[model samples]
Target: MAYYLGIDGGGTKTYALLTDEYGNVLGKGKSGNGNHQINVDIAANSIREATLSALSEAGLQLEDIRHAYLGLAGADREVDYMILHPIIRNIGFTNYTINCDTMIGLRAGTNHPYGISIICGTGTNSAGRNTQGEDYQCGGFSYMYGDFGGGGSLNIEVFRSVIRAWDGREQPTLLTDLLLQLLGYDAVEVMFNDFQDYGKQVPVDAVRLLFEAAAKEDVVAIEILNHQGVELGKSAVAVVNRLGMANDAFDVVLVGSLLTRGDRGWIRGPIEQALLTVAPHASVVTLTTEPVVGALWSAMEEDGLTISEEVHVRMRSFSDFELIK
Candidate 1:
């Protein structure tokens, strides 16, 4: 019997799925960060370990898989691809494709060829396809490329606001106290010193604390979510307009932990309102299927297999791996 593999190689964690040719999921696996820019050797091992775990669960071996698809964060750059492609190939899949994680989220969001996908995770990105089969992407270059308003970005904003408030450069916010408490520090100065020493290693869960503050109607934290909502919405609209889908009815699928957070619509509300300003007719939805399922769908589509509605339903019903948290 032949099997297919689909992997979502993300910055926070990696998710892998093993499925039959008809799209029934057999097993799932997960591991740590798989973004090559974070650490190539560690990322490769994460992917390999996750894939192996899935195969073991499915009671299959690498040689039993006919095809595989990997959607990897940071795989867009040639250097990233060069580093990842071989690692995936070495896993022994006979046929495979590697694509940016944004693309998989896009595919997972809509069945139509033309639509937009916005991902707001530890990082953020947007992807869309037009009726002419041309694809467009926005804001996947990381914050260094001026991208803003992902969870990681929000985390940065929280610290910045706290620092400003501490120095009296900005209005005092509940975030000042909330962040210091969350980090288990008595003073903002110590958190800043430790953060500078650790760099990107600063705990991103500060954004979650911000979300909690927003839920309690804290003004400053609410404003932070509101600001990120507008930024993310603008990214979606930018891709829609770039693909000339502004006037047409299209799906704008929201993906990732931040955008899909089970909040009282703090972030979702503002993004919808902002999108309405630009593309009033555009429909918005959340990605219900795991991205790796989308990778499997793509692999099946490439092989000229028809995806039945039952398969879609079955794939969507699969649970996310625990390690993804």
Candidate 2:
């Protein structure tokens, strides 16, 4: 008779899921930009809308959820959690577990309950749970300090390479024509001016193009992807080492496009190689589960239960756009 609600709050989007005691999702909702990168008002509204939408779809009231979990980045900052807790608590749900998105991401792929998770999206970070479920994390120092091989990093590197090429400082890259074409900046001078502008950030979607150029054997792009993968691998190794999971046959889950589906095969290969150099026995897992399931599982386990293979199999076979019943 219990209901569980789970939320994965990200910088660009928020996904929420509702399910019955049996782990059959009854409803799901989505919203936008629920991170510190966004304004507090906007983040609150997103959660409100997504929560209500899911509840409405399930024909259930907010009070129906016996427990809830919010898996989000940026909660490491006390102020960030401070900003979110009130809004979530006000929604008529009392028992809730809030944690970093990495926690749920790792749990999503393994019942080991303790593994390293590396997330590479607009940004990059790694987190893990020690044997006691005590958490350890690394590499989210922000774009300026680290976020090595993610969307933002990809964009920045490509843009820098293009400008260098335009100025005759760097060798020609296949990315030259593609970047210009994607931006409609047929002229280098125009591209220069556009880069100086602050509109929509100049480095968006650079990784996808990098993938395309690499597909055509563009040396620069391929090198970049390879470097990105290596960087990601190095970062993952640091986290595993910090948690002492490096030599443990520890489960490593790669999340986000760069780690899982990125076309930079050369890059991902190096990353794995680097990790093995640090921990040869480690096993890496590619999660096919959306992290929301981990959030729900986390909530349910508060009562000493586990997410068995029966539930995992069921969740994997479940379809899209339907309320979890």
How close is every model to the real structure, measured as TM-score? 0.84, 0.89
Highest TM-score: which candidate? 2
lDDT of 2 by residue, 27-140 (tens): 888888766546777777777777787788789987777878888767776777787788777766578888888888887877667778888777788888877677887877
On the 0 to 100 scale, the lDDT of residue 228 in model 1 is: 75
lDDT of 1 by residue, 18-63 (tens): 8888877787889999998889888898899889899998999888
In candidate 1, which residue ranges exceed 4 Å CA deviation?
59-64, 111-114, 185-202, 323-325
| Residue 88 Cα positional deviation in candidate 1, in Å, after optimal superposition | 2.8
Each prediction's Cα lDDT score? 0.81, 0.77
Instruction: Please give the RMSD to the true structure for each candidate, in Å.
Output: 3.3, 2.8
Candidate 1 TM-score versus the reference: 0.84
